[model samples]
Target chain A: MYNLIMKDVKLGVPFIFFLFPVLMGALMLIPGWIYFIVLLYFCWITVPNLFNQFKAQNDLMFTSMMPVTKRNMVKARVLVIVGLELLHILIAAIFGVFTMLLYPNLTYLFFPPNIGFWGLGMMMFAIFNIIFIPIFYKTAYKFGWALFFSVMAAMLFAGIAQWVGIQHPVVNDIFYGTGAEQVALQAIILVTGIVIFAAFSIIAYRLAFRRFLRVEV
Target chain B: MLALDVRNVSKSFPNFQLRNVSFQLEQGYIMGFIGANGAGKTTTIKSILNMTRLDSGEVHILGKSMAAHEIELKQEIGYAMGGVDFYTRSKMKTLTDVVKRFYANWDDKTYRNYMRAFKLDENKKIAELSTGMKVKYNLAIALSHGAKLLILDEPTSGLDPVARDELLDIFQGLVADGEISILFSTHITSDLEKCADFITFIANGQIIRSGEKEEFKESYLLLNGAENQLNQVKDRLISYKINSFGFTGLIQADDFDPSCGIKAATPSLEEIMVYFAKKEDQYV
Candidate 1:
């Protein structure tokens, strides 16, 4: 499984894919653009583009000839997706911190570079994974439909989180209120997001495996 | 013991279906699967490798069921697809290094030797190589892994005649060890004529005939009759093509009599394949 993941990471992707993330991570410097980084991260490590590389060289058929099982192939692929997503998040988070340090007194318009926003990011990715994986696994090569459904899911998660925070004063206070109350809410949301990320990704993995069993290469 | 066994296998798609396809290859022999363009040869190969899901039936490789022992069986079998599709954008040496990690017994020496023998440059990107070179590179990888059962689909399609003969000789040498077995599917009957011990012919997604090469040929006799004489024995001929000059085809040996002005000659593998591929219901 490690080999499979490395094959796609090292050989499947080009050199540019590695360097492009640094540029996206830099977006955190722009106060208003900070919110855009979350969506930009998805663009940087797009699942559809990753699949385009695979389809371009017929990599699935080539790798399927190796001594790996179909189940493990799906698992390794999901692991690669998760690994890339985490890499993007880690880099973006670092830059986000740097921006916070660089502008300690600046007024923020959107969700501040706070723990709660990161928690929201986690939930957004969880939704993306849950939607993208099992649907893409149904027909390993078709990227358009997977992109449509998964992006819709990520958008839905982000829109709802943002809207609910504004519509109700109490719900808004937990996430936006000062000091201890915000910290506690951030911790709770973060914990829940972590749990969902782990649980939803696992469910995605098993479901993708089952769907891929019916896939013909 | 049989190296590969496919029994009662069936698979269906919107436009194609392979029905009750069955054949077996022994421990040490080259079984050439001959078929026309859309004759389900690749599908059968995919089934044996479990690359495609089957609607019904079973494939056993090395005496273990493919369903229960796919990973283990895959380790023993080396499959080269109908067309070679490696990471063409990457250098061969780098890609080979990555692929080497998948198998426990990949031999660097054997791989290097094959690369040298096939005249494949390690530094060249796969896309830079010609189609023939791609096939050779694919074969080098398959053979380098110490695979006991080699399954190649149209491995010789892109090679020149000289290169095709060289690969055929290599397959013959591999089977001489009495341990390694090879099952390759190809439309090039001449390749099998030189090295294949067994031939299985498929037409329209059905197994037309299969057996030892000699026995497969023995079932049909090549018939050559003049255009005028063709009509006399036309009903007896299994399949015939009447060109402007003369007519020739295949007929079951038992159905032909020398006294009927029908000349019978021993058929080559190509002759047998051609007759079967062109067989029509009206002639039957």
Candidate 2:
């Protein structure tokens, strides 16, 4: 299962690189703060799409023929998704740092004047990962249109959250507010997000593993 | 004792259904799973592997219910799918290593021998290998695990003649130990004719017939004669097809008389398959 996850991550490297320029280019038009939305979109889109393609190519058939169980297959896929999320976060953070150094005076568009933007980014990623991983896994198991709809739904929910965060002043302040107090709050939000993501991921893994166990190749 | 027994297995999808399919493969025997495309050969294999849930039936492998002893059962079995998909960017060695980690009984010496036999370079990426080579690699992985039962679904589907021959040889060598049982599914009957100890015919998602190779061959005779001659033997005919030259029909050798100017020739596995597939159509 670890090998399967690693193989998927390796296969996804080129795709991650392909997205880098587009992501960096988008930063020129949108504020750095809004880049979190792009990062979330990247995670939601790539993870499931890769797995769907893997299935279409009949990878599951070969894998199933191995001694591995359906439970292991689901676990491997979930681990790959988490790995991809981490890859995306790492790359995006690097880009964020680069963007800041290159354009130091440029207003951190996504982060409020005083907030810890990195922490907010982590929180947003955690929330999206929590919701999207299970949705995609269930949809992928059902396959075909179900998989497509689930991904679209995940993206739509993430979009709405980003929209609400950017539009509402009170909500914006809670996430983007600056200073020592807000910094501490951002840290709390980041930790809470990690905890919730971990809990949800476990639930998703169980749901997906059980559902997929019943699935016929 | 039977190495594998599938009892009254049934499974259905919206577009297809497999009903009450049952067959047994004895120890040290090769059972050819003969079926045409979409004939549920893969489905049946899936059920045996517990990869799919049977609507109602039980499968026993090595004297244990598949549901109760899946992992234990699978560990003793090796498999090669019809379409062997791999992570394209992964090297052959990487795949071997990954699969090796899962099986405690993995034999690296046997695996390396197969790799050399098939001329597959461990350094090559999976995507770089040809279809036949990929199949060979899949077989190598399957054989390396010290499997007691090798279940192959069209293992020779896309192979060239040489590769197919080499695979047949490997199978023969593997079963030479007389401890490994093979359940191989293939539309190409020639391969099975050479290596299979028994043959199972599946059509329209059901098993029509299964028995020892010699017995299966002995039961049917291929008769070719003029229309008039065929008419005289028509009562014994299981099925027949007419061509402009005359008529050809399948009959029991015992029932076919040589005096009718009809020659009774041994039916090849392909000929038998056509006969049964046609029989299936007639029932529909």
Candidate 3:
């Protein structure tokens, strides 16, 4: 299983994709930017290209030929996806801190990059996983429709969360404020988001594994 | 001990179906799996490996049921599906480095030796290799893993005659120690005639015959005679093609009548397949 994950990273994913998170993370330097688009870049560029590479390289057949179970194959792939998602989030989060330090007084029309904000990002990626992994496994080859639906679903989550942060007075206070009480609430949201991400990802893995078993390749 | 056993295996697609496909290859022998295109050759291979969910029946490898012990059995079974080059953008060494770790008995020295012997450059990307070279690279990997059974599908396709002959010689050498068993599937029967000890013939998703190569050939008789005698033996000829001189046809050895006055000779594997293929067409 470890070997399979390594194969996905070393062969299935191109070197440029590893650098995408850093390049996209630089978007954090933009003072008071719509931070969600930074993460959306991953969905827009990396996910489609990565899946396309796997399809072009005949990854399903290659991995199937190995002495591994279909279940493990799905697990390894999910781990790789989750790993990349986390990388993108972490890199952008670091840049988010630099933005905060560089312009502490600069404040906001949108949901600022805060603990609560990252929690929302996590949930958005969770939604993408829940939708993308299962739909893509339906064929385990063609991913265009899966990518389309997943990116839309993730962006919708991001948009709704951002809208609520702006429109709801209490929600806006918690996201925009820096009080100790607000910080504590933001920490709780982050934890909740992580839990949801883990749960959704596991569900996605199970669904994808089941679909892959039925696939002819 | 049987190296591979497939019993009553069947799979159904929307357009085609495998009907009670059954064959077995004993240890240390090469069995040629000959079939025309879309005859369920790839499907049957997929079923044996449990890559395709079987609608019915079972496959056993090395005396163990594939359903119960697929991963364990796969350790000893090396499979290469022809023409499918995986991870084409990746270098050969990069792919090998990842694959070798999966097997417990993977020998790096053996792998290196095969890479050198096959003239495969480790730095060359898979897409850069020609079709024949791709086959060789597949074989090199299949051999390096200490596999006891090799199931290769059309490994000889698209190769020049010399390259094909070289591959056949390599196959023969692999089984010379009477340890490795090969189930080679191809439409090219001439390669099998040179190396295969047994033959399993399939057509239109059914197993036509499976036995010793000589018995498989000798089972049918090729007949040639004057065009006038065609009427008497028209029913017996499995299929016949008319020519300028007279007509030639394929008939079961048991169905051939010496008193009918037609010259009878044992058919080659190609002749047998051609006749069986013609069986589907309207007799001319």
- Which of the numbered candidates is closest to the native, going by highest TM-score? 3
Off by over 4 Å in 1: A34-37, A43-45, B226-232, B244-246, B281-284
* lDDT by residue (tens digit), candidate 1, B25-116: 99999999998888899889888888888899999888999989988777788877646677878899888989889888889999999999
> Per-residue lDDT for B40 in model 1?
90
Q: Per-residue alpha-carbon lDDT of model 2 for B1-284, expressed as tens digits?
A: 78899999999899889999999998887889998888889889989998888899999998889889887888889887756565777788866776787787889899999899889999999889887787778778877887888888898888888878878888888788789889999999999988889999898898877899888887789988888786798777878898988898888777877776787888998998787677767777
TM-scores vs. true structure, each candidate: 0.93, 0.84, 0.98
lDDT of 2 at B165: 89
Cα lDDT tens digits, model 1, A104-207, are: 77765566666777778878888888988899889887877887888887877777777777677776777656589788889888788878887889999999
Q: What is the C-alpha lDDT of each candidate?
A: 0.82, 0.73, 0.91
Which order, best to worst by lDDT? 3, 1, 2
Superposition TM-score, candidate 2 onto the true structure: 0.84
The sequence of per-residue lDDT tens digits that candidate 3 reaches over residues A1-217 is 8899988888898989989899999999899999999999999999988988898888988888889999999999999999999999999999999988898999789888888899988999999999999999999988889999999999989899889999999999999999999999999999999999999999999999999988988
- The alpha-carbon RMSD values of the candidates against the true structure, listed in the order shown, are 2.3, 3.9, 1.3
> For model 2, how does the per-residue alpha-carbon lDDT over A73-144 read when each residue is reduced to its tens digit?
788877766665565666666666566566666654355322244454455555555555555555344444
A best-first ranking of the candidates according to their DockQ comes to 3, 1, 2
In order of listing, the candidates' clash counts read 0, 3, 0
Q: Which candidate, 1 or 3, would have the higher DockQ against the true structure?
A: 3
Q: Compared with the true structure, what per-residue lDDT tens digits does model 3 show for residues B1-284?
A: 89999999999999999999999999999999998888889999999988898999999998999999999988898987778879887889888888888888888888889889989899999889988788888878878888999999999998889999999999999998989999999999999999999999998889999999999999999999889989989998989999998999999999988998889899999999888889976632
